[model samples]
Target chain A: MSKEKISSQEIIDLLSAQTDFTKRQSEDFLKAMFGIIEERLIAGETVKIKNLGTFKSQWNESRKSVNVQTGEEFVIPGFRKISFTPDSELKNLVNEPYAHLEAVVLDSNHEVTEVDDEDTEELEPLNILTEQALEIKGLLSEIQGIPLTKDESKIEAEATVEIEENNTAEIPLESIIQIDPSTENLFDKIQEKMHQKSEELSSLEVVEITKDESEIENSIIEIDDNIEPELIVAANNEESKIEAEEEIKINEEIKIQENDQTETKSNYTAPEISTSSNVYEEEKIENHYTENIIENNDKDEITSIASDVNRVSEANNLIDNSLDPVDYKIKRKSKWWLILIIILLAIILGLIATYFLSSATRCWVKYELFSDENKEKTANVKNNILNIFGLGDPEIAPKPAKIEQDSVAIQAVAEDSIKVDSIPVTQSKDTIVDVFNRPRVYDEFIGTEKFGQGNTLTNISKKYYGHKDFWVYIYEANKDKIKNPDNISVGTSIRIPKIDPRLIDLGNPICLKKAKELHDLYIEKK
Target chain B: MNHKELISAISSKLSISKNEVEQMLDTTISICTDQLKEGITIGFQSFGNFEVRKKEERLSVHPATQIRTLIPPKLVVNFKQSNVLKDKLNEI
Candidate 1:
């Protein structure tokens, strides 16, 4: 057998020794510790006991079980079990001693011993009072097999017969005492005495057997065989002794009566001590006989005991099923580490999949912005496109990828004064080009005007160009001298630009048409 | 809303004139700018933190144009909202 387990009482004693508390106080402290932990679990809160483990509880589904003794099937529905997850430090501490041992593995072909079915019985007791009731039932069953008669004469005659049979079969006759109300009181007294005597004799026998089995073989046989006859004879003797004591009392009463005939009364008292000792010996013999029968026919007896065990198990199951629902709750704790690991793996796989899938197919423009030549060429093309679309100012439209690089490229193009194709060059009426001769510089100066008081650029433009819109050109050329074009001095000079900013890109393609016409005429003449 | 609307709303809520609120706001902006110019960290409790972080100079190539350039080192303002404010907004 394994080492005996420490009970709660032992823990209380140890706690009391360690602290300045009485045994009761230590016991209360232990109880409070468990109570708090249980409350936390019931509230679905995890309680972590430092250096030990965490305790958690959850509901579990119902399950089925079987009675090991009678092989009776039943359900042991759902119940709570407070579970623990040991701290890593504690785990390492426990495993330190056995760390060097490797795991044991066996070949599949190797045979292993199986556990005994009866030894695997689940042992759970009901309420304390209920258990006491069960014990009383067993006692009553033992008493039912006895016959207790108060009449000493009849009991003695039966005892003599039992003694005679004991001499022949060597079996005690206690089993023959059929239960009867008339003798139940006498039997109860006899049984109590016999219980004490049997206990003493059994302990003595155990010691004797352990010391020298061969030396006490005869005594063991005497105990195993004569139990029934001894029980019958003990009961008979007990009754006889009671009658003799009553006779003695009667004699005393008669003497007293003779002295006072007018007030004649009788008293009878039985001396219970002497009879109890004798009955005790007799019952011990009976116990011995039953033990012998069990030893000799163990296999057959076990089979016969099935019905009794079945009844007991059925009662237990009924009580358990009726009350366990409210009292029992199955608990389970979730392992967050397992869930965390799974989530991490899923994220990693998703990121890998996304990276590969996105990179598999993609499209984007690859612009060039390195060389000065490439910059101007691309800028001119971009400006031409922007001009045709009549978009906003080229300086702000079509944002460059790199600001400094684009600025430098535009600066180089400006300094070189490159001649680029314009979108629409609409010159004013005085500056139209001639087609019969080579193209020449159109103008050095278009016009000039003087500003006057209360003369805004719009009003001045209205006087010179017959429109208010061309005042922008007058303002652009004299922007250095004009603080506010609308607030010009009375005799201020304002120069007009030779190249109209609008005409720079607003001219029609009349020269191209005429040149094409001349080429066709020349070809026809040829 | 916008800058003007925020100023007017603050003015109404605080029972102050619009010009006073706007001037005070402008002063606050200038103060913050001055502090940032000296590379100081400013924090508004239960709101956010404004700090200047130094970015080291590095050579980077533009992917589209393959134009490589050397960027200069500079300081940038970093703002981090306090958890108190974040939670308040999340409640909505």
Candidate 2:
């Protein structure tokens, strides 16, 4: 249990201990058993051992890969690999710990609903409201082509004004005056003053209209010079003061109504102005121009008045067109400002959302990496990332062994350093220095090789240790079996022990000197 | 070679009875399986090493239907050939 790898020698020892066979017999049997399997595998035949496993040689096709450090592309030549598939009985035995687990069928519909739920959770009510506002704005822009005509504005305004007037009329002024006698005098005085001002304003307006007509007639007579002055005087004299006063009162009431409507709905001012001007034009035509046209016997006066009425209508159209564009431009400018602000807000919100999302993912990655429960999962993810970067081996089975070995080596080095510090300085300085400098090789064996014809210790050493001079280490490892350095029996198995990498590093001069010293010592002993 | 031929080969090589060889092989396999189940790596020198590895749970999709299935985690027996055996095979 203390040893990680049970070597072939150990297995043979175990087998001999378990049965009545000798060690040599057990070793021979084990060797023969594996030999037949290897031979069959080499012949491209599958060997199935009952209750154990099936061994087969698989041919891997040549493939392309890139070197991680150099970033160079190279082809990995095709080769055969020995693959083993365990028997179902053995597989089940090995998987007994995880036998309760079963493959779960993932429902795609359930996963979609889960994702939608997460999205709904992330959306706040304020965000939904903003989204609705944006939709309504889009619809308004789409419907921008249809003009809101003045007639519709006037009708709407009139309806609202009439409602207000009816509500005010319902609050009877007579009842208010009766309820508060002191306010009654004030109301009567205000009414009397308002009547006097209205009458004065009406008389003045009539006088002004008469004077304006007389001036226009004189101007026409001067232009024609064929018309009688008596006709002009009679045409001017035909205007009645009573009709003019009535028209003035109607104009005043219309103005007051328009003022009230303007206060209630300020946005429709352009349309209201157009409607009011139209009413004024109709009044002038009916009260002054039409009467003058009938009263004058001369056709010239009638034609001139008709022309004047056309000019006034044209002026009103010009005013309406000019005012409508100004109001529209103001509205469009305000809408543009609102749109710009909303866009800015949306961009800010988007930035904030991205920041939070990125931070959440980062926290998740950290949790995955640090949490003990997810250690294996994170390792797999890291390996996948390394593979993507071409820095990891695609075969994952051997990685754990390599990493474990590396950790053991690092721990051994740390322990050796600590041991060096604990050793007393009173001992021989050179031996202490040697102990400190010596690289320690742990009890690990890579594999074994049989002593075949023409195979010397040096050849075996060179094959495994990468240096011909490192033969002494191999002889030292197999000193119990190999009695003499130069002589060895054929077919004797030798365990190729793993050595400390620092002890045989070719690039290190110290390592090379150590190997040379060991060679000299072995030679002198021989 | 098949199982019977393998038993005969080992019996002939070891100069033992077929039954003895078969019994010994079965004992050896049982011992090896027990060790492997305990998470110990059994290395046969130049031949190969047998160990148990844990295969993590993963989501796998079917190629034709694209149905994702969650494959549960399980312990698997894996065998990796030693470099010496690989070289020997290549030489052959």
Provide candidate 2's TM-score on chain A.
0.22
Scored by lDDT, the top model is 2
TM-score of each: 0.17, 0.33
Candidate 2 lDDT tens digits, A1-526: 2237888898888888888888898999999999988888888899988999889898889999999999999999888889999999999998988898777666653432222233554345546667889999989865542222322333332323333243443434444334344433433543454344334433443444444444443333322321222232334554332232223233445434433432222221111111222233223323333343333335465455556546655654664454345435433533332333335434654554555455555654465357664564345435434432335452422232333333233233322111111111111122222332445444688878888776778888888878877777777778778877777888888887788654565654555666677778777887
Q: For candidate 1, what is the TM-score?
A: 0.17
- Output the lDDT of residue A235, model 2: 42
What lDDT tens digits, residue by residue, belong to model 2 across residues B24-91? 78889889988888888899988999988888766688899888776777899899999987877777
Q: CAPRI band of model 2?
A: acceptable
Instruction: List where candidate 2 sits over 4 angstroms from the true fold.
Output: A1-3, A108-526
Q: Over 4 Å off in model 1, which ranges?
A: A64-76, A102-526, B1-92
Tens digit of lDDT per residue, candidate 1, span A1-526? 1222333465466556654557775454444444444445555666665444455554456878899999998987664444555455544443443334332222221111121123222122224446888999999866543423222323544433433343442334443344233234443443454444334433443333332322122223222322123223223454332222232233444433332321111011111111222234323433433443333245444434445446645654654454233222210111332333235434654554444334322210111244453455455445444433334252433222332232233223222111100100110110222112223233455666766665667776666655555555555567678766446677787775554332322233433343344435533554
Steric collisions counted per model:
26, 0
Pairs with backbone N, CA or C atoms under 3 Å apart (clashes), candidate 2: none
